[model samples]
Target: MSSPPNMSTTTTLQASPTGIRMITPKSTEEDTRLNQVIAQVVSFIQTNLCEVDKLTLNTGLDIEDSPRLIRVLDAYGVRYFYHGSILVIMGACPLNSVINTLVLNILDQRSTILPHELCPYFSSYRAGILCSGTIKGKGVRPQLRIKIPDDSITFHHPGKHTIYDTIMIEVAFSESRGDLHREMLQYFEHYRPAQLAILVKIEEDLSSRTPRTDPGFRDRAAQLLLRFGNDLGKEIHATYLENSAHDTSVRPEPFTDDEILEQIQVEDWIGTIAADVEVWDLMHSEPRLRGSRTRLFPTPDRNSVPYIYAGDMIPLALHDSFPNLNVSQRLAIDTDLLCMRMAALIPRFACWRAINFFSPEDEDEDMDYNADDDEGEE
Candidate 1:
């Protein structure tokens, strides 16, 4: 290949896949004009490029006057198309090192599209799919975990009781489509280990008078509790058990058995159990539930153990089974009990898996953030 006259730029160039050929003009007069024109073209390309693309190209272009260079390229009649920093130059290239450098420099800029930058876009679609099984439209819900503060109780006797408390809840969903489990893992991978506690509610007989108040009630309740615990552990994994050895605060050692029985108010116990069951019901419901829809389990201000009839056998079974267990054991039991309850009332509920997201620190942070926002506006 002969060098273009007075340009000192020469080489053979392959046609693009689309067969667009670049023609290099060789006259001395034309060379001088082309150099001036090339400058203008380069200037235009730089100016019109997206901010992200421009930052990428600028690093290598190293030209103090990029706008001028682009204008020179424009004057020479080189057409360029931009696809996110990828510059497809049309027209003529003499195939010299200078031209090659320019092409390669533009290609190098393509590397700036990082994986994390693309995640949000990908998750938007994935979130839609994951939430499709939900009752709410395609919106993602926020997931939350709450930890109750630890407080000491005073006794007229000589002993002090140390208490540790925590709770987990899934308050929101991530905005994405596809498999929620995978997306959740990826989205939360950057944070410390956390568990999600979902509350599911089901209608149960709570009337104060009934027939099966003795061994039958306890037996059935224990079985129902065992069922929920087993299924939840199997479906969501045993690692999420609130009272697992790994979860120090939920362990039974923090307080003596007598203190545990005394400090764990009946209302607190029922409220926590009810919350878990409500979430289970939502997840296990037929036709599936939406993120926007919620089932509330209101705890009575005054606590009283309801009398058990044959109609109330199932709920009573759950209550008796749950109250006697420690936090971890209770979580395990609730998982199974809820699953069994769903099986009988709504057969379709058997197919879904429970995802846990229980964390107390996260809840506190959210509260603090909201408080700060309120204070700021004042």
Candidate 2:
């Protein structure tokens, strides 16, 4: 959570009416304390400080910010960003599919160059890529309006350190997705060379376990069971639907075109469904460009890619955009291998704990936490 010069730290603050947004600490100790108090109030509204339901600063509802904990700088209308989050859930155990796990290894290899070797399309320009890099620009206030893009590429000036953004990718959750295209406008407003932006939409899955507001309920139930037997506990559990929780796979939401996004000139827009990757040209043009997506995500059955793809031949290849020198060929990203590795942590979800035989679902809806991390845009 990078912040301005005066602030010490920042965290998400979520409220019912206001929604969620990151807020930075006030400079003075007293001012900071005031922020904490406000966060506590919002926390109380959201969780009532229940011992069992308390959210750890570390892993609570992702992209969360308690309304009580913000500096309310009227000067800066309203804008915030997220650095990290809990998990967006892939299969039965949401814990298995984390944002960082999906991209870190691939990101490590591509971070230094334009992600996916698109630099060659730029002719003589030297460009670089960053995962979740913060884009700083002035907004309505004194502090900088930081826009953290999921994945972004920047072009460097000839023999200079300063770089300007060219393309950006964003993984947007439905809750805050309304701001999607508007953010692209903000990026263009700040970065003069910004050309393209990709948007990825992923929805959230609900957990089934019910958290108790009363800390002493368990102990009280134990005493009651000693006298009245386990029937009471079983009855209460069944009443709350605690005994029935199933794992039904949920798919990511499809991207809906907005007036703003449509007007921005999508020379092309590609949306991957299931395992099939397809690209579409929203802009009607002469010659009619079509892309072969079969080549993007080769095979789910076979783990290996047979041949190296030439930069020019690949579908969705950036036009006029130079392919990175490193991606001349040898551009095989083992999607299957990465996926299996990403789900490697599934067993630990409840591999088996005391009374864990039927762990049923993951965390309940009331205690939902999610983050779909993607290096160069989700």
Candidate 3:
């Protein structure tokens, strides 16, 4: 593969089993090639390139201009954060996306979580996604590291204008799992006030969640191929628990998290704070997860995902003020009929994932980028 004279970065055609040949990232290490690709990616993101061929790219960038770069990516919903002088982007947030969508949609359908102080709790119209915002705090090493998580649960400082993310969630796949532990530890140790850090490794490729299932038994898959259009006048009866984890079609391979589950001994991780830490795999009837050594869920059922009490989750600073909210029943993410509703939310999320998957691709065709466009607007 040779780079164009003016462009140092070269792209390769990734031919898929589906016979879909699309452009994906090739090593863009050489600075000359990177400058061009960065320009192109930024240009595409800044201007919604409509009629262009599909190009899935993953490349590194040198941040010479911080403000301008932040504006461009933030507008396009690209995940990025600062690490000292470095700008890190956890691109293609595969598994983290699942819970992000789950929690937000769960809040949307029914009920909310935590303190009532965070007015308009869970609102794009209010706080983008119930505790709307990214995690920002002090002592981020190098004093400039900013971690923009795949999704986060934030809350306002009871009586202050500031918002803080109590639950910092991030997901990584096998390829990117090496740095997962270190990054989280940094967040916990260096970044003060880091309450809970969830690092999940997504072993399966979630480029297309709906299509990631095994072909042999896809019929039994949780979110099968079904055109979910707004009702013209037809009834779409939806049942939550109908799609069991035991369904042969679910292709447990995707949840290749067994090894990860076993290794993340919650005790070693946060056992001291470990008044209680629940770990459970949904695939089986009983939970194989336990704290490094401690009590289990109060009265857990099969449907329960790993849950922690408000007592543990709430910052110790605010514990005494809101004693009533400390119980598990009130603050568990799945407490408010969250399980059934999360299942129903799968269809809507399928559409969202499909759109998000394709939208980030660079438009390889001829397109004009307007640098003057929206540069001065608030």
Candidate 4:
């Protein structure tokens, strides 16, 4: 009863699934245009660029010369590419302002780029912790040159663990971590060292925010510290420390080592990890009545607080070095939370405040807080 299909219906029938969608071939004209663009970009990079060992701006290019380069790339709508150690230009993407700024800085002979803008893929550094022995082993050369594939600088180390140690340092700078698991596996399988100590460093860009006064930034940084170190494993050991230097621009106070202990200890370890905590703005220049209780000095049976000191008030009780009470009776505060508080205050106070506890301890004490330095006899 069905009539034969009309000629128009036959022409409208759907093609095979593969042919109907997803694999449509490019037109001959479109293919030709793309090939031409690729050829032009390759030629431009070859003729106009110089190959360098690293991504730094010491590439002999200057401010006057950068605009011309930008124009050349703009003509082809070029963005960026990574080849060897240098970031190369290939094509343009509208969302590449960060890369564009880096290129401008490189041309202008600037010393550094914004840390957030840096792409780990372009640099040879991979992301992870790296450790090397401090002492040299027997029969191994007492000194040897250490070279990193990603870095041009040649470091002189006391031991010959450069191959293994260098890998650790290289991976530390990397932001892309998809390939890290494979690289880590390779390292463990090859060297088979008895123990590996992972060094984790949390660096905050203090020029941007006030983590001390603002709770949001402080809380976020604290969270990152936990994610970076705490979530890594159970075998990890953590410590908190602070290094302060005077910013004559804001505070006239000179840097002083006010504590017997080098590293600043966290106030309450359990409380810091479990609940939200805020540090007193001890260093904030804006005058305000000191708080009732500080991390270093807790109120004892609700005692009356002393009047604010006239000069730069170094609240001795706030520093972890002076713990008047037993820690077991007090709450536990995470090291990361302490670090976050310290980092946030640096920018707000315009001081050279560094939260450093990751480095190895020196055997000899260079300076003592209580002892006065001895001047040479006249």
Best by lDDT: 3
lDDT of 4 by residue, 209-324 (tens): 33343444334333323333222211222221111122212311222333212222222110111111111222332212233322211111223222212111111222243233
Which candidate, 1 or 2, has the higher lDDT?
2
Please, what is the whole-model Cα lDDT of each candidate in the order they appear?
A: 0.25, 0.33, 0.38, 0.25
Q: Name the regions of candidate 2 deviating beyond 4 angstroms.
A: 1-37, 40-146, 153-158, 173-198, 204-334, 341-378
Higher-ranked by lDDT: 1 or 3: 3
**Residue 68 miss distance in model 4 (angstroms):** 11
RMSD per model, one decimal? 31.4, 17.7, 16.9, 29.0
Error of model 3, residue 94, in angstroms: 6.3
- Identify the candidate with maximal TM-score: 3
| Candidates ranked, most accurate by lDDT first | 3, 2, 1, 4
Q: Per-residue lDDT for 328 in model 4?
A: 22
Encode model 3's per-residue lDDT on 42-62: one tens digit a residue: 665533232121123434443
For 1-378, candidate 2 gives per-residue lDDT tens digits of 566665565444534557654444335543444434434433433322211111223223223332222232111222223224321111122231333333343334443434444333322222223233323554211112343454454444333444555544443332233344445545445544455443333332322222233334333323222322233334434433333232112322222223223322111111121222111122332111123322212234343332222322222334334434443443344456634543343323222111121111222232222211211111
TM-score of each: 0.14, 0.33, 0.43, 0.18
* Candidate 1 segments exceeding 4 Å error: 1-138, 142-167, 171-188, 195-331, 335-378
TM-score of 2: 0.33
- Report the Cα lDDT for candidate 1: 0.25
Per-residue accuracy of model 1 over 1-378 as CA lDDT, tens digit each: 875446535434435557755434234553344344444344433322211111112123323223333443454454443322223343221111121222222223222321222112110000100111212233232221211101111111112232111111222111122223322332233212212222222332225322234444334333322333333323333333333333222322222234333322222112121221211111222222222223222332122211111111112223333332222211112233323333332211111111111111122222222212321111
Output the worst ten-in-a-row residue range by lDDT, candidate 1: 121-130
Clashes of 2: 26
